[model samples]
Target: MRFRIKKVINNNILCVTDADGSEMIVTGRGLGFGHKVGEQVDSASVQKTYRMTNPTVQQKLLDLLEQIPYEHFLLTDELVGEIRKRISYPLNESLLITLADHINFAIKRQKQGLLYKNPLLEPIRECYPEEFKMGRYCIKRIKEKLSVSLPEDEAGFIALHIVNAELNTSMSVMNDITRFVDGCIKVIESYYGKKFDHTSLAFSRLAVHLRFFAQRLFQNGQDSGKEEYDKKFRSLIARNCKEHYQCAETVAAYAENVWHKKVSDEEILFMAIHLKRVNLSEQHSD
Candidate 1:
């Protein structure tokens, strides 16, 4: 397909439009070196083309392309490839823009000797281990390619970006979910009078559960419609596991008061079961 250059972003990047008027960002070595507006680009010269359907995101990418170095964008593209290889979940296309912008700013900050710590790093590591591992890989690649050493906190930040893309949510919403998960964990610990072993599988499972639980809470997607089997299971757990069930109730109440979302009975039951497993695991570990 023939592409007409609408704007030359850089020597390697061009903002082009097809015959149907759909805008695309095409990148290749020297693709835009001698190209001007309204010039037809050889399709063979285009190495990569990104079609951003969202106008706002497309504009943001265009603005970012103008500001950040093309190398940073290429580095992000490499990291994105690594992310896809490591996880099977569908990632939002906005990851390209957000992650590239993040890497650009991070490199700039490192040059300025400004180190910002991610507060949710611990929770993120415990909840999203796969994405966090990819984040580490991203920094390792940055160090190899650009010789810039980014802190582990940056890895956490990158993981959150991946999580945001996977959930198709905004960074603010992810922040809220992280905080909510942290709060729920605190509530569980307070009720149990013990801290969780962060390295344990049980804690990891609980954190993962609470992370998605918070997502549903903030998204107002609490379970609806009770089933007879679900009702029986909730009753059985409430009777057999009173302490864990009570802790779950406290967590539900905490969610209701702070997040203003009522946890469904099925959700509470599941929380109680997870809590029981966590308690049992902790006891066995001790």
Candidate 2:
């Protein structure tokens, strides 16, 4: 199976077209050496081929690979492979581009003594435990391979990348989700007149719940329907957890006002319960 070279990125990477006219990014040492467009590439020598089926995503991958060090690119590829095996959900191919870009930047930052701390690291870890664990594994691998010691916050960032990939949402929507979760946190903190220790398990659990709640809102576009049982439970919360229920209402109101979307009563109920636990812990600590 021969491929026609379309463009040579470097001696180790090139873009080629298969017999079916499908474009692929081929990688192999010396594969693109002295290669010219329209030249025949021996498929046997190609070490790996990534389908350039999505033009936008593939172009982003090309752009990122072009800037990243070759060794780092290989490391990122291995990390992605490990993550794929460990996680249950199917990750999008776009993880290749985004995760590569992130890992490359992370290494560069660590080397330069300039690490951007993830403010939501605790929340991210709490919300996506499995992904966060995978992120830790990824960081460990990076340290072993690159000798770059990164902070735990980097693990949270990686987890967010994995979660973003699993959701198959665009980067923009992922950003919105992050912002929404932050807003919800602020609402909770403001109502209680205190900052929740972000590293606290309770805070992390709340963060995780809010992340999924935000995902549901963005995915379905609205709070559509509530089952009779759910309505009853929500009402029960309103009756019993009065203070917690009010805090939830404040959060729901803030989300609705800013995003112009309705928050389901069911969401308010769960959030109130979560908030109740957090507030109770704070009181106990005091």
Candidate 3:
């Protein structure tokens, strides 16, 4: 508990030495209340100690802490480290950081009766109407629980996780599933020169698989169980695309090439034959 103050530089600044032989510049109105340059400073009112972990965040942390009012709670350094560990993609890292920041800010804003309006609302309507609906649903859940509105992207990702979660996958594993989904979406977009819509029956079924993925993430605590969930989701996506969709074999060939897997021509021919039979016979047994 014994600490020494070396110098009182100004009204609020003081040089202090701790019992552990560490010296730091202490700045606060309370620091120099009665303590002079050569006097001992009280150990109380020590808000926090700052030491850089990455050294890259040194400037950023200093800048933020200086301007950003200290909130009741914040994103833990452990959570940030976990994100950087689980995701290697730079885009994902930045997105996850923003997500964490939003969560931190939302908690602080709740006290002021302020709710975050989603800036992504228009974009979600134009670019992802289907996901937007699901996002709205997730927001309803949050609202019912906390009476606070969340931004669309947060709701969207939460819904995506909810829809994608299966009973056997962990969050870390679901992250990979989402990464793969992004890759699949890219390939589909490139082949068709248009974004895929979840409004279609085939895509709707695929979205169901994503929901199962979300279920898995929240339920499954085991790391090894993720592959089972992803395997089911991948198979579900493929099955919906092949059986329920009217996409051309030419399009099928594109997916085959992108996924580096062989999709048999029988898949398309069988779907066509089965569809024709169902149209003509109207018999479930047939």
lDDT of 2 at 231: 81
User: Where does candidate 3 have its weakest 10-residue lDDT segment?
Assistant: 88-97
List model 3 lDDT by residue over 1-286, tens digit each.
6558765544444556788856655554455666666677666755434434444443444334333323211323333343335432222223223333445566567657676565434433433345446456645654664556665556655433332322234445545545544444444346446555445544444434433332333344224435666566546554655533344354345445654434334433333343333233323323
The alpha-carbon deviation from the true structure for residue 179 of candidate 1, after best TM-score superposition, in angstroms, is 1.9
TM-score of each: 0.88, 0.74, 0.32
Of 1 and 3, which scores higher on lDDT?
1
- Say which candidate scores most in TM-score: 1
Candidate 1: stretches off by over 4 Å = 227-229, 277-286
Clash count list over all predictions = 0, 1, 18
Worst lDDT run of 10 residues, candidate 1, spans: 217-226
- Looking at model 2, residue 99 earns an lDDT score of 88
- Misplaced by over 4 Å in model 3 are 1-135, 206-286
Error of 2 at 166 (Å): 2.4
Tell me which residue pairs clash in candidate 1.
Answer: none
